[model samples]
Target: MNQNLPCTEPRPIPAAKKVTRRRSPISLIWIVPLVAVLIGIGLAVSAILQRGPEIELQFASGDGLDVHKTKLKYKEVAIGTVTAIALSEDHHSVKVSVQMDKRAAPLLAGDSRFWVVRPRVAAGGVSGLNTLLSGAYIALDPGKSRNVKRAFVGLESPPLVIGDMPGRQFVLGADDLGSLDVGAPVYYRHIPVGRVVGYVMRPDGKGVDVRIFVDEPYDHFVTTATRFWHASGIDLSVGADGMKLEMQSLLSVVAGGVAFGGGDASNGEAPVASRFTLFSDQTTALRQPDSIVQKYVLVFNESVRGLTVGAPVDFRGISAGEVSRIDIDFNRRASDVAMAVEISLYPERFARQQRNRPTALPTQQGLRQILDGMVAKGFRGQLRTGNLLTGQRYVALDFFPKAKAAPIGWNRPIPELPTQPGSLDSLQEKLVAVVDTLQGTLQRVDRLIAHVDQEVVPEVAPTLRDARQTLARANAVLSSDAPVQMELRDTLREVERAAASVRDLADTLEQQPQSVLTGKKASK
Candidate 1:
């Protein structure tokens, strides 16, 4: 058989030459995008799961806050963002929905604070505006506290113009405007710390009770002995050299602030809570003791002059504390008015550094000895007015401590309060004395007039008749001679001189009565 001849065993027609082809470029394009889409979906799921927890906050007003756009921050770091905001079912407040990061979850404790901050125009300067452009965020503070549930009130309520509250809370009520517009300041010192939160009517509708929130640190300054009063507005003060009213802020023209003064302090007590308290942390200030002689109260037989609340309680011209309370004591047998006051001392000035060694503490007898020494001197409590225009009062303790002259029994009948120089009571007494003297002098004048009418007038009448007869004869003679006319002119001139002298004397007496009668120097 020739090689070229085909074998009967079928030459498998070279199985249609199996062809090898490359995948199309277009297919690869679709595959690449599909893989990218899957990765993106996975990333989105992760993001959703990472968001931590959410809570609701109620606010009376949303002044500077916004939903979704606002962010939550902790320690000035953004911790979460607000998701939504809606009105409550009752339409009384705004309910804000917030989502926080998981990392911030543990920090959300029961004592955690939450308050919306906007542009704050305060006595010092404008603040919180950066939060606006930077996006409103929630600020987190991991305060040192034990509780773990987080809840807060959103305050749109302004601060208190006067008075104080014990804890943090929401705005409950407000007062209807009385005759005065309630915009005066609430100050801690000269520094403005808070505002008029609002006002409300008492259940019985007797008077208005104003609510105020002093921000933390400043809030802690208030204690049982703390006093409050209205600063009113700037007053024009005039003196021999100049006149001015120390008005600084135009915004404060209508607005007012509250102030701090006294407290019944404890030793080494720290601030109760640091974050989100209605008032500032006042514990530090309260624990301190005063260096100067501290006065507890000053009473007067009458109203003390220049005594006002928020007035500086001075010891040797240095302010240690302020007057806290004022009330009257009315007893039928009492001769004078009773005033009650409380004072606070500076802590740092009086506190002593503790030694490492343990030693027996002073006994009650030793403490009494110290106190007795303080009381034995003139160092006693008194009252004085801060500003005459405002009539605000303050308490001042005299440095000279005297022995316990009067037992300070709680239930004992309070005696009359001591009066200041030229007090209201003294002035009233002087006025009464002046009136009595004037009455006596008037009675004497009346008697003199009666005598003139009864005796002098009757005698003069007879003399006048005799003169008339003589004058008649003279008239006949005068008709012939001119000498009578000259004599008449001279008589008229003498009468005029006498009248002038009497008028001069009356003017001198009226202008300088003290000089004429009492020989005392008179005020110009």
Candidate 2:
């Protein structure tokens, strides 16, 4: 019975375990992190694609620039960043590598320009002042060309903005550089309209050649007759017009500048790269009003100590020319030294017209004929004092009727003007003659004084002695008393009675002339 019960229980327990399968919510932990990882991968891919090109810049110096810190700017806007700085292979310059922004990609061209922006004081003015506090940066000027590039040569100094601006270029010639400098402003009627870009000594080394740029609208004022002058620094002149202070502007006084004007706008603008002379000052620019110039030579016999190059050559108080050269030449054949002066005359300077007219000037032969006529009429050249205090002299042409008649000497290339002694020379000669005459007169006076003392004085003493002796003899005779005196008195009385009788007879004859002749007229 126990065995049977155990078998039955075992069989029933095994079939009852058919339990139900339960369904649970999925865990959200891994979903958030998976989505975030996918987003990160997409952002990284976009960043790699958007990166701009890298470029290399060569510069003389790495001053004020820092790798990974310095920025590239265009129009004061950041456009790129400097990523690396290294020395060039030659070690003569710095090699800077930059990574530009995507927007600035088109700016990389063959003609692009780069320069460091630092505080600078130039002839133009004070610039890049903001860099003083904000720190220095690199500046970029986009090229106008279409060609692309990756390497560029950097400028040591900032280039003029006129490179892309509308303007014109011109060349000016000057005797000297004066105070002019690169970046010096160019003015029109005291208004700044351009600037000087470069300067160099001419091939002949006689003058300086300056390159200038004039901005739009104002460049039209420059014509063939336009005049340019140095307006740099201050021009202080104490003259007949009193103290004259001239300057283009206050800035010009400190930084130097140039001025241009004096052309009629109606005459049309001068072509590009036109050449003009740069006068030293406004006065000099205005001095050469005429276009036609004639050259002549003059030989002076007197000392030319006070004469200098650029001395005025005047005709009757009117400025006619300028002394171009003053030299002393010793003639070996003649064995004498002569002072030769070369001058350039502008006849149009004396013309009544304000503007020069196109006309044929007198030829060399015609000039010779005119000079001959003038010489025959006593026209001569002489040196005259221009400034007595400075002892400066000038050439003067005038008519002197008493001057010796001379003919024009055409032995040299240029016709020689007849010369006579200057007024100062004549005065010196007169003084010398006066001194000689005075010397002769003094000698004669000395002789006259000697004759009076030696000859006249001795004769006067003898005459005085004779006069005194005669007076003494007369006195002795009057005072004498003797017998001869008594006898003389008696004789004198007898003579008196006889004289009375003769007088009575003369009276009777005078009363009766007929009685004296015929003794019959006694009745009277």
The per-prediction CA RMSD against the true structure, in angstroms, equals 20.6, 20.3
> Candidate 2's residue-wise lDDT over 151-249, tens digit each?
999999998762467889999999998888899999998899999989999999999999999999888899999999999989985432235678788
Show model 1 residue runs off by greater than 4 Å.
1-17, 22-26, 62-67, 120-125, 131-147, 150-152, 157-524
Q: Which ten residues in a row have the lowest lDDT in candidate 2?
A: 236-245
- lDDT tens digits, residue span 447-499, model 1: 99999999999989989999999999888867745678778888999999999
lDDT of residue 473 for candidate 2: 74
**Candidate 2 off by > 4 Å:** 1-42, 162-166, 200-208, 234-254, 271-273, 289-293, 327-337, 350-368, 411-413, 434-524
Model 1 has an lDDT value of 0.56
lDDT of 1 at 385: 49
TM-score of 2: 0.70
What number of clashing residue pairs does each candidate have, in the order they appear?
Answer: 74, 0
- List the global CA lDDT of all models: 0.56, 0.85
Give the TM-scores of the predictions, in the order they appear.
0.37, 0.70
Top of the candidates by TM-score: 2
